[model samples]
Each structure stands twice: as structure tokens, then as C-alpha cells.
Target: MFDELRKALKDWYKVHHRDLPWRHTNHPYAIWLSEIILQQTRVDQGLPYYNRFIERFPSINDLANASEQEVLNLWQGLGYYSRGRNLHATAKCIVDNYQGKFPSTYKELIQLKGIGPYTAAAIASFAYNLPHAVVDGNVYRVLSRYFGIELAINSSEGERLFKTLAQDLLDEAQPALHNQAIMEFGALQCKPVSPNCSLCPVVATCVALREDKIAQLPHKVKKIKTKQRFFVYHLVRNAKNQLAFTKRKPKDIWEGLFEFPLLEFKSEAEQITFLKDKVQVGAAYKHILTHQKITAYFIIDNFPAAADTEVIYLDLADLEYHPIPRLIDKFLNAHRHQIFSVGQ
Candidate 1:
């Protein structure tokens, strides 16, 4: 059954696989960039980032020499800022220790920053044709449904089972082609929602298809409750046409980014009195992520030229230099008139 499924997948992939840029190159640096950029990001969204990264850092040495801020700037709109930091750190390690060459072995790749088992396997197979199984979200979904596996993907048992199965089914003769075929089949055919089973090459052999339970086969444990957060941003402007912004530290989300001074509130109604005492409210916006919802309040303050201030101030002209969050970008667009208005 495994051999039949593999042959079907490979045949279909030969005619229908996507012509992604990374597929054309066997360079480890390019493959690593694609893998990192594609993490938690769609191919359409990640493509531009991948192109930009390759254009900027054509070589591992180039990435190693680049500053953290520059790398973060290129990765600004892409969330998961830690991935960029990790990529930079890993590049530096490669340059310093490996003489600007990516480690060829899967074990050595895993030891590098941000290169986990999945990433290391992907690089090894795709770049070097090494015998390593690449198991990612798409692979898990595809395999679980195809085999009617009941293990929770988040469980330790599930991880072990899938890894063993993936390794067992991998085509040792053509590791790169086999890895790409499985991943591409998963992404394009055995999708998370409304998979095109009718057109799938291996649908006849799929256990979930035979049982008419595609969606329910790959079960996961109950999801954790997402936390709610509130942010009050003081958009204070002084006589010199300067705005208030501060850099987020390394530990927080959007690290190394800049934003208006923020005061977090536990709830919406609780912040009214706090804002009333500090500054006048201008606008409010809500930004949602996978695990957090941020209710942001935008406050504007115009003070006398002589009023002493304690907030970090930056000239409006320098706003481009700072890394503001998308929520703050929306707020700025909504209140552009007041910010650009002629008044001390």
C-alpha cells in the first residue's frame, strides 16, 4: 500500500506540482530562507519575502554580516519576528564556524539555530538528496487521513508514529523528489479544508476517503483558550512636530519594533477613567492574532511648548525609521488629519 501510494503521488507530482522558486535551486542557503519564511506564512505571502531576502542576502556571509535591525526591517510586516532573529543568528554561526557554508549533514543542521528536525530534514533532502523524512503540518494532515491514524498530532505518541511512518515510506533512491512530492500532494490535494479528493491520485487508497471521514480523521486535542489584551497608545505630539514611540524589547512580540507608548488594560471599560486622566482619546482599533486579541486605544495630546514631558519623542519625519505595528499603522491612517494638522 505504501509503495502504491508513493508511485501515485510521484506520478501526479510530475505533472501538477507548483513551480516555486526554491524548487529550481539546490542551494542550502536558498532552501533555508524559503523554509524559514514559509513558517506560519502562506506561499503567496512568503514569496515576496523570500525574493527580498535572497536579493538582500544572496550569500550566507551577506546575511551573517547584516545587522539585526536591518534583518528585522526586511522582516517587519512578517510576524514571528523571532524567526528573523534566529535566521540571522544561524547565518552568523554558519559563516564563523562553517566558513560561510551550510552544514551538509542533517545532525549538524539540527544543531544550528532555528533548524529543527523538520527543517533539517527538509534541507537535507531538498538540497543534498539525503535520506531524511520531512514531516510538517501538511504531511501530518495528509498521512493521518490517508492511513486513518487516530493519534492526536500534538501528542508525543503521534509524533513518534508519524516520524517512523514517514521515514519508512520515504524513497531513499530519490529523497528530494519524494519529499517534494509528498509535501506538494499534501498542500495541493489533501488540504486542511475541503480537500479535492476526487482529483487526488491516491484517493482510492485513502482510508479516510473509503470511510467518508476525511475531516474527522486527523483529530487534535482541545485548543487552549486565547487570552485577551488591551492597549492604550498615547499618540502625543509636541511643538516640534515630534511623535512619541518606543522600541519593544527582545522578549516581547514585535521585538525591536517601535510603537507609541502603550498602557495595557485588563478590560475595555476599565480603561476609560485611566485615559480621561492621562490624555484625550482619539480613535480605537482591534487587532486579532491566533492566540490574542488586542483592543487598542489611540490617544492624542497637544501640550504647550514649555510643558515638561517624560515620553520618548521622535520627529514625525523619522517615523519611517521606526518599526510600528500594523495596528498602529491603521490608527495613523485613520487619524492622519489630526497628526498632520497645523497646530502647536
Candidate 2:
């Protein structure tokens, strides 16, 4: 059954695979970089960033030598800034410990910062053609539906079972192509909602289709609880018409990103109380992260330099050089005309 499935997947992939840049390269650095950027990110969205990184860094040594801010600046608006930081850190680690050589084995790749099991497996198989199977969300969905497994994917038992099944089903002789086939099958054919079951190569043997459980198979045990956060950002302008900005500190969201002076509130009532005396600049902005829902208000303020030494003032024209959170960027883009004056 696994052999037939593998053959069907390979045939389908040969006809249907997208012409992505990553697929054309066997270079471990390129593969590793693409994997990191694509984590929790879609291919279309991550592709440009991949191209940008390659153009900028081009090599592990270049990436390792580049400043953290440079990497973060390029990674701005991608969200999940830690991935950017980790990408930089891991590159340095590989260069420092391995003397700029990309690790070729799964074991070595996994030890690097931010390189988890899935990423390690990907680089190993895709770069070295190692026998390790890549079991990501796509693999989970494909396996669960085809096998009609009802176990929650987030559970330990389900993880082990699916991973084992994927390994057993892998075409070890062509691990790279096999891994790519299964992932692409899940992404394009066996999609989460309204899958193209009609064209699915394995549709004849798909257990979920026969059992009428395509939507329900591949369950997850954990329910994400989104935390609510309220932010009031002060767009403080000094006498020079320069804006005062603060870099978000570490151990928090938007770390290393710049934002207007911020005051966070515990509740909407608290936010309302704080806003009563202050005037707002624009409509409130709502930003959502995987685990946090934020409602932010921006307000205008005129002041000399504040007591906080961390505050850096920059002209509106010069603001383009700084990296900021998406929310802040949205506010600035919307209010750019209103905020800026005629050339002085």
C-alpha cells in the first residue's frame, strides 16, 4: 500500500509541483535558509524574503558577519521576529563551530539554534538526500486523511504514530523528491478546507474520503487562547519636528523593533481612563498574533527630549531607515501625509 501511494504521489508531483527557487538548489545553506523562513509562513509570502536574504547575505559567512539589526530590518513586517534573530544566531553558530560549513546530517542540523526536528529533517534530506522523512503540518494532514487516523496531531502518541508512519512510507531512495511530493500533495491536493479530492492521486485509497472524515481527521489536542492587550502609542515630536521612538526591549513581542512611546493597559477600561486626557491621532488599529490580540491607539505629543535615555529622535524622512512593527508601520503609512509638512 505504501509503495503504491509513493508511486502515485511521485507521479502527481511530477505533473503538479510549483517551480520554486528552493527546489532547484542542493546547497545546504539555501535549503536551510528557505526552511527557516517558511516556518509558520506560506511559500508565496516567504519567497521574496528568501530571495532578499540570498541577495543580501548570499553565504553563511556573510550572514554570520552581518549585524543583527541588518537581518531584522530585512525581516521587518514578517512578524515572528525571533525567527529572524535565530536565523542570524544559527548562521554565526555554524560558521564559528563548523568553520562556515553547512551541516550535512540531521543530527548536526538539529543542534543548531532554531533548527528543530522538521527543519533538520528537511535540510538533511533536501540537501544531503539523507533518509530522514520530513513530517510537517502537510505530512500530518496527508497521512491522517489517507490513513483515516483520528488521533489528535498535537498529542504525543499521535505525533509518534504519524512520524513513524511517514518514515515507513518514505521513498528512501529519493527522500528529497518524496518529502517534497508528500508536502506539496498536502498543500495543493489535500488542503485543509475544500481539498481537491477529485484530482488527488491517492483519492482511490484515501481512508478519510471513504470514511467521510476529511475535515475531522488530523485533529489537534490543544486550543489556542489569545491574550488581549491594549496599547497607547505616543507619537512624541520634539521642537525639531523629529519623532521620539523607543526600541522594544527583549523578552517581549516586537523585540528590537522601534515604536512610538508606548503605555500598555490591562483592560479596555484602563485604556479608556488613560486616553481621557489625551487626544488620539488616528483610528484605533487592531493587530493579531498567534496568541495575542492587540488594540492599539496612537496619539500625538509635542515635547523636548524625555528623561529616558533610550529615546532616539529621527526626522520623518529618516524614519524609513528604522525597523518598526507592522502595526506601527500601518499607522505611519496611513498618516504620513497628515504627519509630514511641506519641505522646509
**TM-score versus the correct structure, for each prediction:** 0.65, 0.66
Positional deviation of 154 in candidate 2, in angstroms? 0.7
Candidate 1, poorest ten consecutive residues by summed lDDT: 301-310
Question: Tens digit of lDDT per residue, candidate 2, span 1-344?
Answer: 89999999999999999999999999999999999999999999999999999999999999999999999999987889999999999999988999999988888889988999999999999999999999999999999999999999888899899999999999999999999999999899899999998877777899999989988978888777899999988777667988888888899999998888888889999998878857677788999998999999987654334466388888877767888999988898888666544232
What's the CA error at residue 253 for candidate 2, in Å?
Answer: 33
Question: lDDT of all predictions, in order shown?
Answer: 0.85, 0.89
What is the model-wide C-alpha lDDT for candidate 1?
0.85
Pairs in steric clash, model 2: none
Write candidate 1's Cα lDDT for 29-134 as tens digits.
9999999999899999999999999999899999999999999999999999999999999999999999987899998999988889999999999999999999
> What is the TM-score of candidate 2?
0.66
Error (Å) of candidate 2 at residue 46 is 0.7
